[model samples]
Target: MICKAKAQWIGYPPGSDTSKAWRTGDVVIGGAAPQNAKLTVTGNIVQTSNNNYFNTARLYMQSPGAIPANGQTYATFAGNTFWNNDSAKWQIANSDLTHFGMMRFSATGINFYTQTAATSAQWLTETDLASMLALTMQRGGNVGIGVPVSQAKLHVGGNGSPIDTIAQLSANMVIQASTGGRTTDRGAQLEFVLPSYSNGTNFWGQGRIITVAGDNIHGNAVGKMIIGTRRKFNKLGTGSDWYYGDDIVIDGKGNIGIGTLTPSKKFTMAYSGTQLNSTTPITSEMVVQASTATRSVDTGVALEFVLPANTDGTNLYGHARIFAQAANNTNGNAAGKLVLGTRRKYDKIGAGSLWYYGDDITIDETGNVGIGTLKPTGKLAVNGILLAKQVKVSQSAANWPDYVFTPGYQLPSLDSVAQYISENKHLPEMPDAKEVETNGQDVGKVQQLMLKKMEEMTLYMIDMQKRIDRLENENRELKAKSNNQH
Candidate 1:
């Protein structure tokens, strides 16, 4: 079955049709003739795959009820009944938006309701749409890539889920810096910029994050990240514009470098792009690496913590330090020593010099520790006062004073003891004042000698007691004979 009809309507020159006269059956269809044959009506056509007729069940736009004071006509959206629907009341008004000093247009702006409003009176009318909308290449707007609505300045949603987690694929952006050919690629740098005051059109980068190929080889692209900031100076620019300098770096080896690109340890804080093995030093460096070669005795690493005299950062004194150095300058047999030192500050009357600094504790290579002295002669040495609740001294049986109670032990007579003390001006077997002063007294040795003296005093007291007892017995015998004679 084939049916064909050709119809054309054309108005005369300078003629128009403004008539709203009733026109319903102007285009009608009947029977099977209208089923297969295609009747095309000229309008803004939305393409349908099957090329079918559109059902006119939905209502068209309502007439404008009244003109507002702004001389704008508003109409309710067609077929809007449900709340939170894809419906918006539209109007045409004079454009008054002014931004960037370019051409301004206002009739193209749109608005919608996001909240639940049951009726027309419950709707909150928005008089401005520029603040809510994220325009493309326009001011007062945010840009969203692959996002239905964006809340940030720039929201990018990438396609083809780069990760296995489906829920997390909602807001994610991945950047890949690759060279199409077999060439070394400098990794991508993302810069945060701000409009410069010198020129509104130009922008200056304030900070940047750069990702680099960890291995310089073409195919092997281990990732290294650098986060940098722009300071007052630039690459030969006179403080007008600035470039980025690396402030922190994380290499592919999982080493974090705070001030240097190459970190030797798991976490390294080098100063001014240089490590501790370098001779040249920067003035503003907080961490220092001294000279490596030609290093002499007492030369190694020293981390000093200094305290300022006042809030002005002047008269700084080295308050404390963790210092390690080679005690002996010999090549292979260099004795390493770790020293803990504290600087003591003294308040002067008028003008006194000298901030005091001395080693509070030291540990040497031979495992000898010195409390107040750097050079320790024993396993434990203290040059200051030692306080303890109890002390134990171990001595051999021959050295102990318990030998005094033995029968074979020689106990000096009282006459001999008196003579010996009068001659020596000090106790026998005890160190004199001069010797004790010159060489510090050993606690264990002194305690042993004192015990020996105490034991000797006990023996002399026993001998005197025996002599008194003999005298008493002789007197008693004499008195008994006298009484018998009387």
Candidate 2:
């Protein structure tokens, strides 16, 4: 029944007892006037019905103008609230004016109740709210999924646990900026701004911003991306300051850098340390492997080098590759060959068109290394002149020229040596000038032959000295005999 004016009723209606105050009808206590009527209920407004429609009571506030800001000016409930009793308990205060628009449910103990939205079975029920309340009480702080928990802020998971905690999605998860037209502005980014502390004083810390768009992961910063520490002064009165360097960085073009921010290649590393002093050989720093069997196809692990074009720009610099071939035996007879060379086009000697150059250095299955040739004839074959500071050739006893000084060695006569030199234009057992001009001298063999000639010439000089001594004695005796005859 609608009560439009002031009405005071002290007693219960008809057959209703004090336990059942007013039975069976919708009750409206206020009038249509703006703020004229007031309704005060000394007892609890209870609803006890099995019917689904009218089994609930709602305190609906309707205002023509602005509602009062003070919650007490509106409806208030003051009682010991019980939910499915003994399961949860809380106290409500109508006089709590500071918290104006909020519903206060101060738990009587560790137990509390909360209501969720209506469903098909019930208007309101304790869905997961009870569990949520338990978690809040247990954690003693706010709960978050993707941030850190602070004194007042309830940030979600701080250590990457949120990803695992979230339900798996069937499709890709795209966090785009807008749902509209495709543009360069569409991307996802995560930023971190941490606070730094020194001696209990807080300072502005470094910030790192990571963005993902298309196929790139970009790292950015407003100022320097790295921060260093300052240490106390030492005995020399010099304060030690650590160098600021990039810990890790990757550009949009898939270039990765370690200890450097600007990487010019696919992967670049910059580091400073003392050279290893150990006598043992060290292992390789990096290794690239291709395990696929692509003998029929042209595929392998290649370390490619591409340099910029020249100033004229008429011809771009060609690529050079050091590659370990797969099973392909196209260039050589064997498979799995190791090749190092450029791919620059060169005019074939007796061919029609230009062809790509072959390997500058190649190693065959037999462990023979070749330079400037794919097929090697020996253990090491160089197609060009080899310049070296020194060359030591191992010689056997019979191969060495030390036999020239042996006791039974046969030395040619000086006259015969001179006759051979006059006829051949060279020393005995030595190549002539024409032969030397045609073929380059073998350094080791040439030195041995020269040493032999010098040893033979020493024997000739000794024989000449003995003949001169005998002639001098003969001359002295002849002079003495001539003096006696006189």
Candidate 3:
């Protein structure tokens, strides 16, 4: 029951102001058909609109009932309410009559609908409706850019995405000091600044992760990253006066250093003690440990030291390694060993990842040390012949050969020793030739046997001297008696 209001002006009287020229019709506020616009009478205003450029509807809600959640606390909160009209679109205009925002989706004017996803898993990396987000800005709470809910102070979520274009893929944050010159601060940084307790105006940085350009050579410029953690210091005039001792620096050469400005190697750590003495403990500590009680080859820890090799621009040749691994790979039984390895002679890091090495030394679980071997049988085992300047063998007083001179000790007669040697072809209480060939002789016990034999030989020599003296005296007396008789 709606129609376009077309009342013809009959005529103005000569002296009167105006006159009403109304035919049989109901007053329509919009164009021809208002039902197609989905017009409804909500309040005092006769809201009428049709799909046309000029026809429009405006709702002015000035009471508390208009808000979606009148008691919209955090606990029992219903979300946003959309004021949707089924006509062409919505265009909220100022007094100047310009559209405030753009409309997306199937709508034409300003709409509350959007296409941006709230998570990085959706791969919605594009920036449509990025500026004006339909966010609840009622309280200054945690904000999440691409997450379902804010779990942190600032939660930025996005993972590996295809980066085919410059601004198309990947969720990234850029902090730029674009207007400044290429000084020490080439780019911007994220700093943890703490307010000073002295006054609210003063602030100091507890830590900062900053980026800098190595040079201003445009195309050939290198970049370095610096992560600084300030040490505890007394409050001074300004932050420039504070001393920060620890900084992790990653240079353009891909070298990293902790507590050192210059990193000469791939990774370096430094600790500068004020004054070091004999009692100073080993510093610049690094520990590699297995997380669980189970120990195996897969769960072992190793520190490899390697140098770059002459290969296809990217190869490292292992020089040496210090590792701790399971001594035996048995399932139920477990033991640990510390192994040191040197690079095998044939490997040059040519093609395959060569992890095999020569086990130069090992300290096993039974306190046995092996050199040039893995399994040591004794307290100290060496696969090769050991070369040394001198060797000292120590024994208890009970083992010393001075017992040969004791009163109760019996010395073997020479005739008996000769008889035994003729029968056995070896000394008594000594190993045979076959035994010596199979199992090596103990140097300490052999030395003791040699000393005992030498002492027995000395005693035999002394007894023979006494016998010669008696025979010489008897011969001299007989010669004197024969001469006197003549």
By TM-score, who's the top model here? 3
| Candidate 3 lDDT by residue in tens digits, 218-316 | 554466788876765522324555654437888879899886757899999876444434333423255676665765754567798888776675587
Regions of model 3 farther than 4 Å from truth:
1-301, 308-315, 329-334, 345-356, 406-408, 478-486
Clashing pairs in model 2, backbone N/Cα/C closer than 3 A: 145-156, 145-157, 146-156, 147-155, 147-156, 147-157
lDDT of each: 0.60, 0.51, 0.60
Cα RMSD to the true fold for all candidates: 19.8, 17.4, 14.2
Candidate 1: tens digits of C-alpha lDDT, residues 88-172: 3442222321111111234432222232223233222344333323233223576554443556777654445545454622335
Please, what's the RMSD in Å of model 2? 17.4
Per-residue lDDT of 22 in model 2: 28
Give the TM-scores of the predictions, in the order they appear.
0.40, 0.37, 0.47
Ranked candidates, highest TM-score first: 3, 1, 2
Write down the TM-score for model 2.
Answer: 0.37
Residue 252, candidate 1: C-alpha displacement in angstroms = 18
Q: Lowest-scoring 10 consecutive residues by lDDT in candidate 1? A: 96-105
By how many angstroms RMSD does model 3 differ from the true structure?
14.2
Against the hidden true structure, what lDDT does model 3 obtain? 0.60
